[model samples]
Target: MVLTLVRYIREKGMKPGDKLPSIRTFATELGVSQSQVRSGCLRAAAMGVLKIVPRSGCYLADVTLSGIIGPFTLLFEAMYMNVQPPLIDLYELKTTLERGIAKRVAVIRTIEDLAELKRLLDAMETATEHAEMVRLDELFHEKLASSTRNPLFFSLMQVIHSMLRQSRLSYKDFVSEFPQSRKDHRALYEALRDQDALKAGDIAEQHSNRRKLLLVKNY
Candidate 1:
């Protein structure tokens, strides 16, 4: 009921400060009991999507970035509640977004961004075990996202990171067994630093594809 109402308002392109339909009118329009409409409205308020003022009408929430992400966070939580492995489709999507971003970063990254990438690479190099390597790898990508200077991209990457955290750490053992990633990172860092977009894109795609392949082969 709550989701239905929320979806309707969203479909209408309503924004914060917009007034919702009155309870009685909304109930009649939706052909629902007034109690049901009221319940839905109340739940929407709890979900941070609407606000009800005493003696006044409901209004859309002035949602913060976290508030916007809240519903999706809950959805992902429900998807992972059983500790099942994450879907490969998500990794595929992540790789696509990352490779595209890496291409752009390679072409347009600033000197400071390259320096940060190098620092992250060095940190990854020093990490001796799976756990440390996983942490460093995440930092490496965070630096990559920062190079793009898009906060929404950074936020999405964080969500993607959380989704794959376990698989990523587990896969680090396979990554650590080979020196490929180290060599790849060096080439990748140089390519980006030199603004060699094509080389950087190729390396980024190869790196991501290799990781995906390793996951498939081992687990």
Candidate 2:
């Protein structure tokens, strides 16, 4: 139904801000019930493909990357809920992706990117609250990914971060290893600053492995 509606919009040459057919009209034209049409419209609206205007009508919205990924966000949440993968598995996946991201960032990170990372690191260093530290930790990694100047890497990290949040895993869980983690982060940052891609990648892998070991020992 969503596909049909999107196709209909495209077939009609509808652009953003263009009004869509009424739900009843869509239902009749698509040979679906009004309820189904409404549901499809609502899904499209949520995906940013359309906008619901209350009593006014539905209109096309400016499509964006976030809008395109919105539906997948729900799917990701559902998968995590059902599968409940081990923390080690999540750590492994994060490590694999971040190793490459670190290398790329080391080669291409700009001055501004380094400054942002430095800020996040400084904040993390002083963060006494477990929750705050975890938040800062995630932001530090996100900023590192962004420094790679690859949108796809950043998006993938965002998805992984979402999964971590859903699993309720916190940096505090690895408190016994916090000191090493801090040192690893600092070293990784220096490696990037020096444009030492290989060193950065090694540090990223070691950092991930250490966290995985901690999780295993504790949980």
Candidate 3:
């Protein structure tokens, strides 16, 4: 049912935040019971694909197809077009890449890289919204990747972030840990500033572990 609704949405070219059709109308058109349509909408909302308001009905989430699917949306044409890689699988890849990339970046990062990261840290401190917080967090990691001077790792980081975005936002732990998260980021920055590769990698691993634990529990 979620796929059916998504198909209907894509066909109509609905924009983010656009109101979804009424459950009765959807049931009539999609040839499903209203209860079934409601159940599907609820599941989609849980998956972060739609927003359900008590008084306002359902609406499309602010997620794009490319963002919801993966960053490699335009990168290739694969046979499993309808399949999205498992969220845990993507998170595992991200965790692995970040650990190694953090070490390399610490050893090779330049003053310019530090400056950009510092700026992002400052912005993150002032960000109050969950969406903005997530955006800044992703940017902070992206900078770390770019600082490594390795285009492959940098591109992979982008893909990982894009694909895992919804997963990141689904958990309240992502926003609730803001203060501690800042300290984590600062620790990594300090490690980079001191060119301590081991320390940077350790911090990255610890950070990923915390998120991984929370992700598994929540998911």
TM-score against truth, every candidate? 0.80, 0.69, 0.63
**Model 1 CA deviation exceeding 4 Å by range:** 1-6, 22-47, 64-78, 83-85
Task: Give me the candidate number with maximum lDDT.
Answer: 3
Which of the two, 1 or 3, has more lDDT? 3
Residue 75, candidate 3: alpha-carbon lDDT? 37
**Candidate 2: segments with Cα more than 4 A from true spot:** 1-45, 49-66, 82-85, 166-173
Cα-based lDDT for every prediction: 0.77, 0.80, 0.82
Candidate 1 has which clashing residue pairs, if any? none
Cα TM-score of candidate 2 = 0.69
Which candidate comes out best when scored by TM-score? 1
The clash number for model 1 is 0
Quote the positional error of residue 103 for candidate 2 in Å. Answer: 1.1
Residue-level lDDT tens digits of model 3 in 1-219: 777887899999999989998999999999999999999899778767889999889999998544554423323223224676466666687788889999999888889999999999999889999999989988999889888876667677777777667777887777788888899999999999999999999999888777777776785
Residue-level lDDT tens digits of model 2 in 112-202: 9999999988887777766666678789888888777766667767777777663334444654556677889999999999999999999
Residue pairs whose backbone atoms clash in candidate 3: none
Q: How many clashing residue pairs, candidate 2?
A: 0
Q: What lDDT is reached at residue 22 by model 1? A: 95
Ten residues in a row with the worst lDDT in model 2? 166-175
